[model samples]
Target: MTTTRTVNRAARIVLPGVVAGVLAASALAGSPAHAADEEVPGLHLVTLTGPGTSATPPVTGAPDAQAVLLARQDAVLETIGGPATAYRWTTALNGFAVELTADQVTALESNDDVAAIEANTVRPMAGHVDLSAVRFSRSSDPRASRGAGGSGVVIGFVDSGIAPDSPLFSEVRGLGETRAGFSGTCSPGEGWPASTCNRKVVGAGWWVEGFGPDRIRSSESLSALDVVGHGTQVASVAAGNSDVSVLMNGRTMTSFSGVAPQAKVAPYKACWAAPDPADDGCSTADLVSAIDQATADGVDVLNVAVAGPTTTDTVERALLGAAEADIVVVGAAGNGRSAFAAHASPWVTTVGAARGNTLRGRVSVVGGPAFTGASRSRRQLGPVALVLGADVAADGAPTEDARRCLPGSLDARQVAGRAVACLRGGIGRVDKSEAVALADGVAMVLVNDRPGALVDDFHTVPTVQLSVADGTRLTRWMKRHDRTTVRLAGVGIEKDASEAARWSAPGDDRASLLKPDVVALGEGVLGAVPDAWALFSGTSAASARASGVAALLRAKHGHWSASVVRSVLTTTARPLAGTSTLVQGAGRVRASLPRPGLALDIAPTRYRDALEDVSWEDLNVSSIIMRGGGTTTRRVTNLGTRAEYFSVSARGFVRHRVRTTPVALRLGPGESASVRITVTGGGNPSRFDDGWIVWRGARGSHTRIPVAISR
Candidate 1:
C-alpha cells in the first residue's frame, strides 16, 4: 500500500593519524627497539611486498612463502620499537595484523618493503532456502538421489560462536566423521567443553582478548558458545539437521531443513558478542586469525556472513589464500544501500537479501482495487465505517501528527466505531495501528504516502495497508461520501513467493562491479537459534542459503573449483521479473542440474580505472563514459561431450549497442574460445545502464553475463 522512501545509513570508517613526533623522538634517540607495553592501543593491518611475497600465490599451503615473509616481518619488528610481545596474525600476502604504537606504525610504513598500512576495521555480520528449487534436495537430483546432502564436505562459518548442544549440531545429522583434511582444534573454556569439537562440528575456536579468568562475563561469555545467536542461526541455515522444526512464538513450524543438512560445520568465532545480540563486534585481527586457521584446516567452504569495509589488507590477503586453496567463500553485502567493503573484494561471493515464502494476510477494499500488502493477523474484518485519521483527531496538534496517527493525537470518542484511515510516515506501521486501537477504533487502514510502495506490518487490531494510488482513491471517496466502508481479508498460506527487499544492500560499488552475485530468501527466514529456532532477516541470512547451495554443489562435483561453482550459480540464476541487474544481480538462485553446453568458466574482468588496464578480478565492466564505448572479452568453454552451436544476444535497454565479433560459435567438446563484446553508448550516461549478454545453446541450455555502463 503506501510507498515510503527508505533511507540507508552508511557506516563510517575513520583511521586515526600516526604520531610523527613520537617516531622522530624514538629515531633520534637510537632507542633500543624494545618499548614498554603501555605504548599505543589501537591495532593496524600492515602489508609488505618483497622478494618472496605475492598477493595471489599459486599454492594455498605455501609454508615456505609464509616463513620467508614472517622472517622479514620479524626483522622489521626488531628494527622498529617493538613491544615485549605482540598479538599478530600473519597471512600469505606477507601481511601482519598487530596492535602498534604511533611510532611503530610510522616505522613500519617507512620500511623499504612495506606496501600498505591500514586500520583493523570491524565488519558487521550480515541466509535460507528451499533445497528442491536449487536441486539440492529434489528426489531426482543426482546429489539428492545419491543421498549426498553435502556428505564429506566441510563448510566453515567465520562469525560469532555457535551453540554446540543444539540438535542441529548433532553428529547424527552430519557426516559423523572427522574430515581427514581438517587440522584445527577447539579451545575448551567457559561453558564450552572439549567435546564441542565432534563429527558434526569438527573444529571450534574463538579469538577475543580479555577472555581470561578475571573478567566479568558479558552476554556472550569468553567461550566458543553462541551467546549472540546470529552464528547459530546462520550455521543452521547453511547446514542444519534434517526434518527440523522451528518454534515461532510458541507454535512449531514443521518440516524445515537446511540446504546441506549433512555437511560438517567448522565454527570459527571471530566476532564477539555485543550488548545488542543482533549487532556484530569483532576486530580485523580476529577475522584474519579465523581466516588463517580456516585455510590451514583445509575446509571446502568459508561462509563469512559479516559486512564491512574491505580496506583491511590482512583479512583480504587471508581470504585470497583461502580462495587459492579452492574454498568457496561467501560474504554478505552490507545492509546499507551502498557499496560494502567486506563484500567488495572479488574473492568473496557476495550475497544480498530477497523475500522468502511466508504466509501473510491480504487486504482489499470493499468496492475498490486490491492493494499489495501483508499483515500477521489471520482474522478478517467485515465491512466497517471508514474515517480519515485527520478528521477524527484532537485539535491543537499539527495536522501531520493526526495524519501519522500518533498516539494521543486521535480523538477516542470520534473514532470509536470506525476503521481510521491513517497516512504512512513519521511512525512505525505497527505502532500506528496500536495508536488507533488505543483511541478505541475497531480497525485501522494505512495508506502509503508515496506511489507504488507496499510495506508489510504487524498490527494489534484489525488493519489493512494500501498503496498510495489506492489510498488516495479511498481517502477521496471517504471525503465525498458520508458512509464509506472497506474490508480486510485474511489469505491462507501461499508458496513460491519472492520480492527484492528494500533493505537489501544496493550494488553501487565504487569499482563498478555488479554486486550481490545473487539473492536468496533472507527476510523472516526460520532457522536454528540456540536451543530453539527463530526467524532472522538481513543479508546474513541470504549468505547462509547460498553457502548451503555451494556445499551441495561441492558434494556433487568435488573436482570443480570454487570459481566454477560461482559461475554456475550466477549464470543459471532466475532474474527477478521487474528488477534491474544492479538490484538483483543474476537474480534469485535456482538449483538445477548443470547442463552440458556452452559455459563461461569465468565472468569478464571488472576494472577499477577508466583505462581498464589493471585487472579487476570479479568486475564485469571497468568504466564507460557517456556517449563513449568500451570492449571486454570473455572465454566460453564447451562442457558438453559433443560439438555445440551457440548464438549470442543482449537483453535490456537500447541506449547501448552491444555487438559480439562472432555472433555465433561452434565449439567441440572441451574446446574454449574467447568472445569480444563491444558496447557503444548512444546517449549521455545519467545512471547505470544494466543488461546481460546471453548465450543460447542449440540443446536448450543457456547462460548469462550481467553487464553495466555508468559515468
Candidate 2:
C-alpha cells in the first residue's frame, strides 16, 4: 500500500524568492563566501530504475527490498555531500527531489544507478459550467439518470487549495455518502482541520517542501484552506455541492452548480500563493508528489488545472502512470493562444476553453449607436459627460499612464461626475476600475485592444467594456467633438452559442495526434471561492469541467476502461460551427453521455509505440490524424446489446478526399471489426483540412470521429 506524507517542517532550506521581503530574509541568514560549497543553485529531480507503488502484479522481492532501494538512492546523494531531500516518491514514480549545486547535478547525470536527472520547473495555475450549456438537463436527457450526480466517483484536484468553510462544499441534506476504495486522509494545518473533510470533501493535503516558507505570504495558510481562491474555484466547478446561490460583490448573480455536483472532492494543494502574487505557482517537485499521492489514493478522476510543457516531463510521466492505473487524467491547454498546447501527452485529455454564456453591458453614445460587451456590473448610470482618460491625467503624470487608468494617475477635477474611458493593459482590469472610482468617476468604460476572452470581472464602479474596433471609433468621436456624453445601459445575461475563447491555446504542430482533445464551457463561469463566489475563465477552468464529465462517466460505467471513456467522449462530442479543429479540437464536450455503438481501446504497449514514433496516424483512437494524404486502419468493438448494421461516410474536406473500404459493416454482440480508410490530397491551395467520419447505425446511433490533415 502507498501513503502520502509530508517532509519534516524543521528541516528548512533557504531558497530564492520573488519579493523584497524574502530576498532580505535570505540575505540576513548568512554570507555567500562562508557557504559557497553548500550553495544550492537550483532544484533537480532524479529518477531511479525501480518499481513504483502501482506496479502491475505488485513488486515481490526479499524482505530487505526496501532497505536495498534506500541504500541505492543514498549512494547517489552521498556523492553530493548528503544534501537534504525536499521530496521522495514511490507511489506513482520512483524518484527524489533535491536542491543541488551545478556540479552535483552534473555528477548525478552520469551516475549509473540514476535513470534521469532534470531541472524542476514551476507551472502557473490555469473552471466551469452552467450545466445547460453541456446538455445537462434533468428534464429531458436519459443519460442524466445513469450519471446519478457522479455519486460513486472521487475527483482529485491538484490546485491551490479548497475553502472548507464555503457553503459550496457543505454536506447538505441530499448529498451522497463518500464511497469506499479511497485510502486518503486529511492533514490538519494552521486553519484547516481534519474535521473539515466531510462527506462532500473526502480528503485534503498540502505540499510546501518545494515552495519554501519564505516565499509564502504571511497571511496565507500553511494548510489546505485556500487564500488564493483558484483551487477552491476549480474544485467547486468540478464537484462541489450543486444549486448554490452565487454572489459577486455581495450581489446575487444566479444559482451555480458543479458539473458533477455529488462527486467526492480530494484536494491536493501542490501550489502556494507567493508574497508577490504574480510569482505564485506550483513547483515540479510538489506537482509530481501530489499526482503520485492521488494515484495511490484510488481517485477515479484527476484534474490538473496548472499549465505545463507540451512535451513529456516528470509530471507527464506521473500522469501516464495514473492513466495506466485506470484514473481519468484531465489537464489544461495553456492560455497563451499560441500553437503549443500544454499537457500534450496522449494519456492526458487536454481541454481548451469555450465561451458558453456571458453577462453583456451596453455602452450607448447619447443619440448615437450602442455597443455591447462582456461585463459583471449591474448598476445603472445615465447620460453623463464622457472624458478621455488622457484628458484627466494628474499633474506630472504620463499621458499614457492616464490612458490606461493607472492608480494615482487620474485627476479628480476632470474625472468627477463623468464616465472615464480607460484602455486595457498595464494593470489588472479590476484595478483600472478602482482607479476610476478613486478619482470619483461615476462610471468607467474599458477598451479591449486585442482578441481574447471577454471576462465578467467584478468592478469597483458601474463599468461597461467596449470592443477594440468600437473603442477606436469612440475615442475618435470623443476627440472630434467638444462635449461627449453616453448612457450606461444595465447588464444582462446573453448566450454565446458555442464559440471558442480566443485566448484558449491552440493545438501544437508536432503531435501526430491532435492536442486539446476538446473544448468545454469555461468563460465567465461562476463558482465558489474563499467564502464567496466569483467568475472564472481560461483553459484551466475548462479542464476542471472536463474532469467532472469524466467522473460522471466513471460513476455510470465502472467497468469501462479509461481509454474507452476517452473514446466515447471524443466520438460523441458535438462540433462547434465556424471553429477550426486546431483551436476547438473535436468540439465542445457534452454531458449527455451517449453510448457509442462501437468503442476502440488502445493497449498500453501500443500507446508507448505510437508516442515514440514520429507519425502514428492509426493509433486506434476515436480521432484520426493524417499528414497530407495517407491510409490507416482502425479496429472497433461492438459495445451495443444486439446485432447492428452501420454505414460509413465522410464530410467537410476542402483539400483532401477520404474513402473507407467496405462501405457497410454488420456486427453481432461482442464482435470486433477493422476498417481501412484512405485519404488522397486534391492539390488545392488549402494546406489543411478537417472533417468528420460518421458511422451511422441502423438503430439511429451516430459516432463521429474527427479527422485533421496537415501538409
Which ten-residue region of model 1 has the weakest summed lDDT? Answer: 19-28
lDDT of 1 at 668: 90
Instruction: Write one digit per residue (lDDT tens) for candidate 1, span 352-418.
Output: 7776654455545567656545555567786777788888878676767988898889988888877
Tens-digit lDDT track for model 2 on 1-711? 000111111212222221110100011111110100011137777766544555443556634544555676788789879988988776665678898887786676566666556566555677221211111111111112122377868899988889887766776655565657788899899898788887778888888877766778888888888888788878888886766655434544456678887788989999888887556777777888899889889898999887655545567667766876678889888665533567766677888877776678988888676888877677677889999899999999999999999999999998999999999877777778889989999889998767444556667777877778888989988988898889887668876654887667777544576778898876666666664555566677788888888888887777778887787777777889877788888898886567667777776545444443423454787777666778888887777889999898998877788999878899997588998889996696347788888888888887778888875
Which regions in candidate 2 have their CA more than 4 angstroms from the true location? 1-40, 59-84, 100-113, 127-148, 248-251, 359-366, 375-463, 468-498, 604-618, 668-670, 684-686
The candidate that wins on lDDT is: 2
Top candidate on TM-score is 2
